[model samples]
Target: MTIAPRDLLRRMFDAAIAAAQPARCVPACLPEPPKGRLVVIGAGKASGAMARAVEDHWPGALSGLVVTRYGYKVPCERIEIMEAAHPVPDAAGLIAAKRIQKLVSDLTADDLVLCLISGGGSALLALPLDGVTLEDKQAVNRALLRSGATISEMNCVRRHLSAVKGGRLAAACAPAKVVTLLLSDVPGDNPMDIASGPTAADPTTCADALAILQRYAITVPRTVLEVLESGRGESVKPGDPRLAGCQTRMIATPQMALDAAAAVARAAGYPVHILSDRIEGEARDVGSVLAGIALQVAGRGQPFTAPCVLLSGGETTVTVRGSGRGGRNVEFLLSLGIALNGQPGIHAIAGDTDGVDGLEEIAGAHLGPDSLSRAWELGVKPKDRLADNDGHGFFETLGDSVVTGPTLTNVNDFRAILIER
Candidate 1:
């Protein structure tokens, strides 16, 4: 029953992703058929899949629309699956956002609005507030992506700028009981943070968003600043009557995914330790810290000992300064590989559960004792690539990049370090 380190790591990663798939997690969370119409509306990388899951499980007729990243769409017979730009939203997303907002409006209390929310909804559900154009939001989104701001910070700013986010969408569905099913990809799994909480009441205010923008040095258009400063951009706060009928259910989460991965590792005869499912901070710094732990377990056996796998799940930020392909997971793996220094019997894999990291189609990469040696042999300077934030390029050249296409699920980043004695 001995398993190769690389295959074992991949299995654990796959298990983590499969555990969070909408088809498996969404049905139980689905609310009973509404007295009136059942309208499904959502936006995220996994929204398309979530819609399909709802279509398959519901007994009565349901119709709706959902927006997903360009390549993340899943076919649905009843619900319309729309494709849009992500990370930096485009005109398509703006149009879709307006349409989604309209769809949820004008509903009665007897009607049910089933909102499917997951990661990436903030950008996919882009509908800039009045006085702020889509281009303005795009510029701010691009800057925020490169600013090394945590997801929460970026989302806080987004909530203030968007017309649909920060519980505005839920407010639009006023009088209709809004039931939201979420697949959490953020660090804390806060419903308000997922997809900027389009269907959940936001406790954050315009002041909080403005402070995040100032802290990150992210420049917004004058109109955006005016909205925030004038308090016009404030979100629907808690206890708002518009959101009184709203309810949220976390269908899948990072901790659940991590626990599933741990089960696979344990059944394969390796003890597993999940450090944290909410770890955050800079990608490289997290990698370095994990490397230190792996080294300790591999050498001194002080913590969990060797012949075990360490698992963790959480999103990490990368301050993109280099003009190279960058994904937080790949950056993490590259940094982890370098810090390991080709230590024997230490292997790791890091990938985004949704199968895309940053802007790259690649999920993430793998690291072994010879990852550095292989890069050096291929004339690739690991340190230089790391500095340039070119982890995708570094691993792609070595044919070690993990590509899973669109996994149709996101529980954030998954990292596994295997220490074999």
Candidate 2:
């Protein structure tokens, strides 16, 4: 059966999303009823869906609060789902963070704190340290995001500045078994990095957060600096007594998403090639390199012949040099288009698997051989847009941004394409 390249590309992306759907991942990882009370807590874009998953799978009296990004809520039987600001946290997040902190503090040794953590939780569950207000945290967070810092580095600073993160949430539930069900969105999938590791032991220290701040050249108030320098609110260490019963289990990840896309490609009469699930570096550079590989396959039939899909999953970083809207996925596509120079019959799509890329509402963008031509007719100039880091804007004008709202689950970035005659 012959398949259109665009159709095959969509199939690959859809399969990736289906594989990482929260409904399938969140249910089976839930813990049974505890000996005493069961306290459910979580924060992320997926927290709402995770809460709903737990309610459907676990049959017991459960009560707790979870914070998710606005417009990412799912109906839950008992767990309270609170909508908060994401990418940049807001006042709603501040209140929810305090509430969850108080909830964990009330836990007894016999109780079980089932903590559901995923990507975007760091900004969603915002409880700033004493003397450091939410505004302070917000300022720092906003700067770090565009500083080209890796996820690990950005999270390192976040863990130190929060009252609920860096193991403090687990510390509050001392004596109670804190079991964290994590759906990793960050490469390396470090528990300490996901949502800043709210219920896991933190290996990063206050000094480390300060060092990151220095590396990024982020300027904060003296009070915020003092709090970090004093080390008064350091997170639970690896062997802290309060974390003796804390545990973390990864339920979903980027590899799983890549595998799913690969399956679709193979079944669609195309040779599947997975580049890397942990890919990272500058977004535009990654795009240029991928374009080279596509050219090789399309022109010389090297790597893989026609009717092959190249797949990759990983977080890509973008250094903000322009005052325009930017997302890693869109940036990649814009760069890819420039490199390809409208090379015929090489179609592609690049997007965040979670259905939101960077700060935009679009999940990602889809491209065809005529994408540049369509974009040109739409008055889109590839070089000018890329120079401004306005890839989202470029795609938006061309009517190519793939907006799926919130998929409510994040495995990281997904990139796939079909090269054909």
Candidate 3:
């Protein structure tokens, strides 16, 4: 049976997401039950699912709270699952953050604090420092999101301004051993970068956050700037005594997801090439570069020949210069389609594993050899939409948007390009 390019690409993407589901990855990473209480606390798009996995597997009594995106909650009787905004901080997040901090306070050495962290926790675990208000954090988050800054850079700034992040959460749980199970969604899978390392020590300093703000030309509230300038926002650094008993386990990662997708391609009888699970930069620029590689394979057959699939996973940024709806995955696909210029026998799919791209609930989009022509027929100017930073708008109009709702897992963005002769 011959598999269509689009169907094969979708299957590959689904395989990637399935490999990172909390139920599949969290159970094995659960730490041994503590001598005393087992308290669970977490924040992320997948925290609810992670908490559920723990409840289903834990032998002892466990009770705690976890905050996730508004629509990403999974039912858990023991672990309270709270919903909050993502990609931006909100009052609900602030309240949850405060409650979460309080839950870990005054713990005993025999007790265990299990921290389940994943992508979007930085915003979901929103607790500003003394001088910084919730409003200030929210504003800074907006600025950072629009600044085209890398995830690590944005998270560095976030850690300095938050009271619960940057190892402070772990510090608060001092005396109680902290066991962090991470579903890494950032490039390189640095524990500190995942959810700004709420339960992990931070090596970055206030100066680094300040420099990032200046580099991105992002202006923060006066209180935010004051906190950074006065060094009052310093996060717990590595080697802190409070973090000595903390342990982090990366249960899922982009490389793992990419490998899963590669397996699907191999089983489908197509040779697979995983470019890099850590690709980064502006979405459009990366799309163009990948298109060049696909073109090379399609025309010259130099790099692995034809009838192959190119896979990559990473977080991409968008400058957001236009007024249209934007998603990095859609932006990438739009750019790739424009570069391909309707070239035959080349098809691609790009989507966030968590079922969201940019601020939209839609996962991402798909592109084919006729994508550009179809857009023209629909009176949609691909370049114009790309200029407007409206990849979601462009793809949606062409009926190519990939909507997966909430996959209950996140390992960053997944991209697959299939080339056939």
Candidate 4:
């Protein structure tokens, strides 16, 4: 009943994703039906699945619309599921954002608006403010993705530039109670950071968004900059009466996913070490640090003894310097492999829990002691690929890319390192 290292790593990743599935986590967090209407609306990679979960659990009548990434839709009889672009804004997303705004605009105090939110919602709920076009938002999004800006910073800019984000959606349903069930994908699980807090109050402002754009040197349309400078795009501030009745609960999180993976490792007879689930930074640098820890455990047995597994969950960024397919998980794995330098008995897997890393449909990849050697034999230079931010290309060439079409849930990134004596 012994599992190979790769199999064990894959099993651990499966366990992590299973822990955050909307079907399992959505049932318990659902609120009671309101007196008037129960309107279900949301946006994210997981919102379609979450909407289905709500449909299965609720006994009363409910209807609404939700937008998810293309290929992530789930069937629901009452709630309308729409597909849109992710990591970038599109016309379909713009239409859905407008529909969502209209759906809750006239809700009475007795009505309830249940918003299902997760990663990718920020892009899926795109509705640029006045004078800002979808193309403008898309340009800024591309810049942010390539700028290596943290999720919070990128989202802050998105929140300020959008017509429906940053509590504006909740403000639209002022009289109705907003109960937001969040599958958190950001570090610290801040409600305002999840999907740009469409149903929660925002403390960040236009000045803040301007600062982020400047800090990252992200070039945007001049009017977009003017919107921030004129405070025309200022988000709903804290203590806004519009959000007074808004209720937010984080139903799933990165820490929860990491804990589930730890359980799997322990059950498999490996001593489990749970690292910080909030780890965030440049992906390659973080990979090198984790490699150092793995090397320590494998070589000196320091920190933790051999035959142990190290688990961590958190979103990492990649500042794309080269014009190649870039994914944070693969970048991390590539860097880890380079630092390990063919260290024996140390294997690793890194992937996004949502089943896609960066803009690619590939989830992530795995690394072994022979990964470097195999790449060399295949005429692939690992260091050059890493420098070009081409982790996906490198792994695909080695036939090590992990591709899981769509998991319908997102708790952020998962990383597991197996050290055996």
Candidate 5:
């Protein structure tokens, strides 16, 4: 075989990235040329790249605004791309989100509101719900990050407490037909989970959002809690008439990317197995579970024959008991490597599809037999690093960090486990 293990891994990663290319994913999903004005608005790490693709493909005159993470900006004409805080919202996000809402306020029924949404959108598109202060929202968001809630559940809370989430944005375009092209970073590709369903209906209720908050013990200002309890700022429901004309399409997803990677693996004569596209929960715990499965396959070959790859994708959370500087992917890899205990003939990779793991530039990390021994030789303790909540620093020092810059799209987490015969 011409493919080395690492080479095959690189090839698969490349395929995954190719599957999520904004230029291709965005253009292919473009709706037919609408007769009316085409106003482009979006938010996410990939929003800038998606906007540029829209500008290049759509023959209609397009103009609008979008917000993206600070370093994930791309060039676009007519549509303004604003940079903002990610994984957390700031004044920049607040301002840009407001601009987007204002831009659609007066749209006529004939106009087309093309919303380009992707991962990181929830933070980049932050516009607190009426009666809730931005500070209040920020505090709640920080709490959620530490609460170990899944992205969908966290978004459930955000959707009900936001001015633009849960179907409100689509409602804002009222009468104007809205078509959302989404590059899903959320698992399950549930339109409702993509950036909190800015252009889709929200099946969750204020009561649901409140339940999530209570489940995590995320305390909020008394006024904010009252608003949720009172349902004063509840999101638009699934059957709301305003969303009747709204249409959404998943232009990209974790499964699509994983399928692309699997294709590469198959071409190389390696057997492949995909567990799921929507696995959830704490990063380390999920890693342990995957490690257990890998061990079963490697030892007894019950799950698959030797020389096979196990793949899975989904978003995971970190409870943040430590002060680590890593995201869930890195944490997962760390815990997974430790669980495997440097076992021979097994290696793995875990990362976020957006080229970022956690809040760092590292896409994720790789594991091999020597990984654990090497850490020990260098005076690095896996448990210590994991406890500090700093997977990035640990992996960075070991030179095992997978940094791919910004792939400009997010389909959430990607994991690959390889076993040699």
Candidate 6:
């Protein structure tokens, strides 16, 4: 059965996402119900789905609030699903964060706090620290997003600036055994970086956040700067007693997603090459690097021969200088397309596993040997769009943009390169 390159690429992406779905991965890791009460609290793009997974399997009386990015909600009868803005915090998220703080407080040792955390929770669970207003957090968040900072660096700043992140949420539920079920989107699967470690201990300090801001030249409000300098925003450390007995389990992660995609490619009779699931650095730079590899395999057959699929998963950043539709996945694909220079027998797809790239609903885009020709026919110049950081527009005009509303799970970005011999 011969398969088209584009079809095979889409199937690989679907396999990766399907491997991380909450219903399939969350149930087995759930702990037995506590003796007192099960307070289900969570925040992230996947928290709503994770909550619903709990509701489906757990027979205990569970109730709590979970905040997810708008349009990422999953229906649940017992747990309340709250919607909030992501990548930036809004007033709705602020109110929800306060309510979550109240809900988890005053719990006894026998009670259990089932915390569902995933990517995007850092912004969705936005509760600015005292003296740092929501506007202040917003300013810093906006700057961080545009500053080309790595996810860990951006999250370090977010952790110190928030009231609920960096273990404060777990601290609020002190005496109640906290169990965090995570779907990791961050590279390395560090629990502390996932959702800024809301229910886990943080080792990063205010000084580290300050350094990240300095490294990226991201200037925040004066008050936020002062708070970081004073070390008042220091997050809960590893030895903090409040986090005692807290258990964290990574139910799904980027590596697992990549493996699933590899399985699909292998079954389709294509030898799979997994470069890495933790690749980072600038998106455009990574794209250039991958293009070199694809070319090598196609021309020289150096590392591997033809008729193979190279798969990878990880979050990549973009230093946005142009005022265009900037998405990391799109930007990466655009750069990849240009670098390949319409090299035949090579096709690729790049998309965020969560189904939203940057602030746009478009997942990502696909690139073929004729991608440049199609764009030129559509009056979309590859270099011009790349200069404007408008990869989304470039792909859209070519009718090659991949759109999957919301996957309800985030294991970060997925990239695949198929080289036909």
Leading candidate by lDDT: 3
Model 3 regions more than 4 Å off: none
Per residue, candidate 4 scores C-alpha lDDT tens digits across 1-421 of 9989999999999999999999999999999889999999999999999999999999899999999999999989999999999988899999999999999988899999999999899999999999999999999999999998999999999999998889999999989999999999999899888888888788888999999988987789998988999999999889999889999888999999999999988898999989989889999999999999999999888999999999988889999999788999999999999999999999999999999999899999999999999999988999999999999999999889888889999999999999998
Candidate 5 lDDT, tens digit per residue, 236-347? 8888999998888889889999999999988888899999988988898998999999899889988788889998998889998877775998899889988999889888
lDDT of 6 by residue, 211-270 (tens): 999998877899998889999999989889999979999999999999999998998899
Tens-digit per-residue lDDT, 1-421, candidate 3: 9999999999999999999999999999999988999999999999999999999999989999999999999989999999999989899999999999999998999999999999999999999999788889989999999999999999999999999999999999999999999999999999999999998889899999999999988878899989999999999999999999999999999999999999999999999999999999999999999999999999999787998999999999999999977799999999999999999999999999999999999999899999999889999999999999999999888888999989999999999999997
- Which parts of model 5 have CA positions greater than 4 angstroms off? none
Candidate-wise lDDT, in order: 0.92, 0.87, 0.94, 0.93, 0.87, 0.93
lDDT of 5 at 119: 89
lDDT of 2 by residue, 1-421 (tens): 8777777777778788878777899777777778899999999988899888888888878899999999999988689999999888899999999999888876777899999898999999999988998899889888988998888999888888888899988988988899899988998888998999998888888899899889878887787799889997588789989999988889999899889888878887778888889889889999999999999999999888886888888899999899888899999989998999889888899989778888888888987778788888877788888989999988888778887778889888999867875
Q: Candidate 5, which ten residues in sequence have the lowest lDDT sum?
A: 1-10
Q: Give the TM-score of candidate 2.
A: 0.96
Kindly report which residue pairs in candidate 2 clash with one another. none
RMSD of each: 0.9, 1.5, 0.7, 0.8, 1.3, 0.7
* TM-score of each prediction: 0.99, 0.96, 0.99, 0.99, 0.97, 0.99
Per-residue C-alpha lDDT of model 1 across residues 281-358, encoded as one tens digit per residue: 999999999999999888899698888999998889999989887899999999999999999999999999999999
lDDT for 115 (candidate 1):
94
Task: Predict model 6's lDDT versus the native.
Answer: 0.93
